[model samples]
Target: MIRCTGVRHRRLTIPSLAANARQIAVIGPNGAGKTTFLGLCAGMEEPNKGEVTLFGRKPSEVRIGWVGEFPDRTMLFSRVYDEIASSLRFRHVSCRESDTRVHETAALLGIEGLLPKATDELSGGEKALVAFAAALVHDPEVLILDEVDSHLDEEAGRRVADAIKSRPGVSVIACTQNMDTAAEADLLLYIEEGCIRHAGTAEEVFEHLKETCFYPAVWRVRGC
Candidate 1:
């Protein structure tokens, strides 16, 4: 479970919020503090007040996998294999085990063929897959994605959605502008002005947004 109580940082504020769903989508306008909320959840930023916890422990104490909008910026190693193994290496996992895990994660994401290639040689979509492989190699309890699908093509976006589905045990918190993608999440958080205006299942949240442009176009067309 992920819980936030009296969280206040910068322009974002949450008096109370708890999420136990396996997949939660954060949707909002460009500057609605979606990333700020994700930052707090990822432990990348400490809240100025209150607390954010994962499974009863502070978020900082939990193992989390994070993939941001630009994976290249965070890519530490040039080689794909090395990049995927970086986290395991930092944790002092045996080289053999790390190698096995890296290959497994790459294969899981259907990026094994690119493992031997240099990161710089890959395309943008391929880079995102590699970054995802790196984040998933360590089997984090929570996976946080910040608009990772924004730059991806349809195929790449589908691959990301499939990858998330493949890891049902890991709680996924993704901030995305794609209403269709957001509609697929188990829960939705509609944030605005640094506050969550709505939080519920897709049907519930979309009902609240049905009159607004934020509602899924497909749903609107279907009158759903």
Candidate 2:
């Protein structure tokens, strides 16, 4: 769980947390600062003015597992198994435990077969699974996934959804524009111009969204 007080960016200002959610989905047109807000929640970036905390620790002080829109940044090693194991190693988990943890996470994600392949050898979807595996290997308390669903196809997308629901001990905060994706979230935040303009449960957000002024359908379906 996270709470932000006195957050400011450019002309945007939020005196207190307008939204609090265990599973949050942020949506808005591009440049709305959805990514920026996610970064702040994940402690990947700092708020120029306020305090943000994860389980009571400062944003930067808390340890979190993150997967970005781009899966390429997930690697520093050549092999998939090593890449997944790096988080454990960095946290000083014993070598034996690291291997065990990596195997467990990969198996759960159904990507254990890719363990032997080189990082560059995996397809985009395959690499995405690897990135998620790496993040889960440590089992951090919070997981920040930035538009990860955008990289997946239908079947793979379902698998990602199942993975999120099955995983335990982590609060997920995903930034996405997919209504299907938002439906799976416990909460939804509409970020406009670097601040939260509206927030509610998925049903509430969608209902409000249908009644309010916003732009460019999230998915652009020919007929919805």
Candidate 3:
């Protein structure tokens, strides 16, 4: 579970929130504090006030996997295999276990073939896949994504969505502009001007946004 109480950082604010859903999607307009909320959840930045916790512990104390809007900016190793193994190596996992986990994670994301490739040589979509493999290799308990699909094409996006579905035990908090994708989450947070204007299941929250462009296009076509 993720909880926030009187959380405030920069322009973002959350008086109180407790989310136990497996997948939580944060949707809002540009500069609406979506990324800021994600950053707080990922423990990338400290809240100026109040607290944020994951599973009864401070967010920084939990094992978290994070992927950002620009995966390239976070890439460290030149080779894809090395990048995926980086986290395991940092935790001092044995060589044999690290190798096994990296291979397993790559296979899970259908990126085993890219393991031997160079990160720089891969295309944008391929790089995103590699980045995802790196993040998932260590089997983090919480996964935070900041508009990761924005840099991906349709097929890559589908692959990512499938990969996320494969990890039902992990808590996923994603900030995305894709309403279709947001609609698939277990819980939705609609924010504007740094405040969460609505929070609920897709149907409940979309009821408040049916007249807005933020309504899922698929729902519109279905006359929902």
lDDT of 3 by residue, 1-224 (tens): 88999988899889998888899999989999988888888899899999999998988899999998899999999999999999999999999999999998888777899998889999888888888888888888998998888878888788878877788778899988899999999999998998989999999999999889999999999999
Off by over 4 Å in 3: none
**Model 1 per-residue lDDT tens digits across residues 1-224:** 88999989999989999888888999989899999999999999999999999888988899999998889999999999999999999999999999999988887777889988999998888988888888888989999999988868888777777877788789899999889989999999999999999999999999888778799988978889
lDDT of 2 by residue, 114-167 (tens): 999999998889888899888888877788989988888888787777777787
Q: lDDT at 83 for candidate 3?
A: 96
lDDT of 2: 0.79
Clashes of 1: 0
Ranking by TM-score: 1, 3, 2
The clash numbers for all candidates, in the given order, read: 0, 0, 0
Per-residue lDDT of 41 in model 3: 87
RMSD of 1: 1.2
lDDT of each candidate versus the true structure: 0.90, 0.79, 0.89
- TM-score for all models, in order of appearance: 0.96, 0.89, 0.96
Off by over 4 Å in 2: 10-12, 211-224
